[model samples]
Target: MDLANLHFQNPEAFFLLLLGPLLILDWWWHAHKRKSTIKFPALAIAKKAAKGSKVRARYIVPALRMAALCCFVVALARPQNATEVEYTSTDGVDIMLALDVSGSMGTLDMLTRTDQAKLGVMNAEKVLKSGRFWDYSRLGYAKNVMAEFVQKRESDRIGLSVFAGNSYTLVPLTLDYGALLEILQAVDDSSASGNGTAIGDGLMNSLARLEKSDAKSKVVVLLTDGIDNASLVPPLHAAEVAKALGVKVYTIGVGKKSGTFLAFQQNPWTGEISWGEQPIPAENSLDEKTLSQIASSTGGRFYRAESKDDLEKIYSEIDGLEKTEIQTIAYARYQEKFYPWLLVGALLILLELVLANTRFVRIP
Candidate 1:
C-alpha cells in the first residue's frame, strides 16, 4: 500500500480534531482562573528559589497530550491507502489493412513536399542533389498516413498485410498499436517481392487473417495504386468470398487520374539506351471498375485519392465510420493505515503519563 494515496473510510470522524484545541483552551482558561499572586518586597530569597525551580518544563506534558489526542482523532477517521484498478471489455472492430508494395509504388509522382506538408505528413526524406527538398514516394506517403490512422484507433484490433507478386501477413490482429506502427514504418517497395500487383491475393491474405476473428465487426481496407496483373485468383472472386463470409471491404485507389510516367527503352543491336516520358492512361493503369465492384460487393465504399490531402480525408472518413464499443470496470483495493496511528497515539499518551508522574509531578 502506498502512503501517497492515503484516504479515510470514515472521513466524518475528522470532526474530532476540533476537540484537541477546545481541550487546550479549557486547560488554559482554568489555569488562568487558578492563578494567584502574592506581594513580596524585592526579597532576594524568593528570587533565588524561583530560579532553582523547573516550572517552565511542565508545559511539555500538555503539548504531548494534545499531540496524542490529534493522532487518536486521525486514527478514528479510518485512514487507508487505496489503489484503483480498471478492467476493460470491448466488442471492438477487427480491421486488416491490406497494402500494395509493388514496384509501381515507387513512383515519384505523389512525392511533392508541398502536398505532403499540407497533408501533415511526418518524417519525409528530402531528395537532395543540389541541396533542395524532395517529395516522398507513393509508398512513403502511404506509410505515413497509415501510421497516423493506426494511432487513432485505441480499442480496435488492427492487423497489416502487404502484397505484390505474392501476399503475406506482416502483423496479425492485435491491440498492440506500437508494434503495428513499427512494422508499418518499415514497409517500402522492397518489403515485398516486387514482381506485379496482386489485388485478389492481397484481399485473400487479409481474409485469411480475419477468418477466426470473433469481433462484432470485421473489415478490410485495401489500398492500391495499380491494376491487378499477377493475381492467380481474379479480384471479383475474392470479393465474392468476402461477401459470403460477412466481411466488408473498402477499396482505395491512389494517384492522379491521368499523368505521364517515364518509360525507358533499350536498343539491343546498337547497345544504346533511350528514355522518354509517356502518357499513362489512368483507365489502363488503374482497374477502378474492379476495385469499385469489390467494395460494393461486400457492402463497402470505394474511394479515389488523387492527392495526399484526399488520402488523409479518406482515412479520416473511415475512422468515423468504424467505431469500437468498449466497457470499463474499475475497483479499488485499500489497506488499513489506522493501526500505526493508533499505536503512535497510545505511545504518546503513555509517555505523557510517565513524564507527568515522574519529572513533572504536580502537588496541590
Candidate 2:
C-alpha cells in the first residue's frame, strides 16, 4: 500500500488496462441500442415501488466485473519492492607522530589551566620557574592536539615516537587508537634525564617504525622546540633515508623566541602561586633550518607554531594533505509484490460470476 518505493517488473503488461473502459463503453452503447418489448400498465405508484434495493443493486454486478478487470491489469504488471544500498572502501594511509619531550618543553609559552594566551607576556620576565604547570606546558598542549589529530584519521594506522637526547617508540603502528592514547598520556618530558635535542635521532626513529610498512602512502609528523645537539645520526642523513623509502616527513618548530617569557610556580604546602621571568637564549632557539631541510628532502612541508592554535592548524593541514579518498558502490535488491494483487483479481472475478448467476441472471 506504500507505493513510494514501488516499481513494475513487466510494465508493458499495463497496456491491457485499456480493455476495462472499452468494455464499459460497449455495455452503455448496447444497453441504449437494444430493443425489448413488454406490455405493462403505465402507473406512477408501480414505477416508484420498482426502485427497490434489489433493483438498484442490479448495477452492482457490472461494477464488480469492472473492478476485477482493473485488478487483473495490475497483477500482470508484476509490481515489486526495491531498496538501494551503498558501501565505501578506502585505500588507507599510514602515519607516525614524532614528538620532542626535551627539558625545554617545560618552558611555558602561554598554555595554562585557564587557557590564557598571553600569560608569559602579561607577566614578562618575573624571574621565577615553577615545575607545577605540567598540564599547561608545551608538552601537554602537543599531546592534547595530537590526540585530536588521531581521532580524525578514520582508518589510518598511526604510531608514536618520542625523543630528546635519546629517541624511542612509545607505540607501534596500529589501528587501535584507544591503546595508543593510553600510552601517549602517560609519557613524561625526556624522562627528566635527557640533556640535548636529538632531532636527527627522532626522525630516524620514526622512519624505522615506517620501514616495513606496505601502505600506499606513509608519513612522519615531527615537532620540536629546540635545536638538534646530540644525535649520532645527522638530521640530513636521516632525511635522505626517509626520501629513499618513499616516506614524507613534516616538521614543526613550536614556541616563540621573540622576547622573554614569564614562568609560574605554586607552593605545594601553602597553595600559594608565584611567577617569574625566563629568557630565550640564541643557542636554545628552534633549529628551523635543519627541520626545514629535513621536510623538503622528504617532499613534505615545514610549519612554525608560536601558540597552541597554530600547532592545531598545522596538524590539521598535515591531516588534510594525507587523507584517503573514499569510493562507494551502490546496488538494489527487489522483492516480488504482485501476488496479493493477483489473488484479489481472481477473488473479484469469482464473486462477480457467482452474483450474476444467482441474484442478477437474465433469461436470454
lDDT of each model, Cα atoms only?
A: 0.82, 0.83
Residue 342, candidate 1: how far off, in angstroms? 1.8
How many residue pairs clash per model? 0, 6
Stretches of candidate 1 exceeding 4 Å from the true structure:
1-6, 12-66, 82-92, 102-140, 151-156, 175-197, 226-234, 244-246, 265-275, 281-283, 323-333, 362-364
Candidate 1 lDDT over residue span 254-347, tens digit each = 8776786433445689755444445756544678899999999999999998667788999999998998887999999888889998999999
Note the residue pairs that clash in candidate 2: 125-277, 126-276, 126-277, 127-276, 127-277, 128-276
RMSD of 2: 5.1
Q: Judged by TM-score, which candidate is best?
A: 2
The estimated TM-scores of all candidates read: 0.68, 0.77
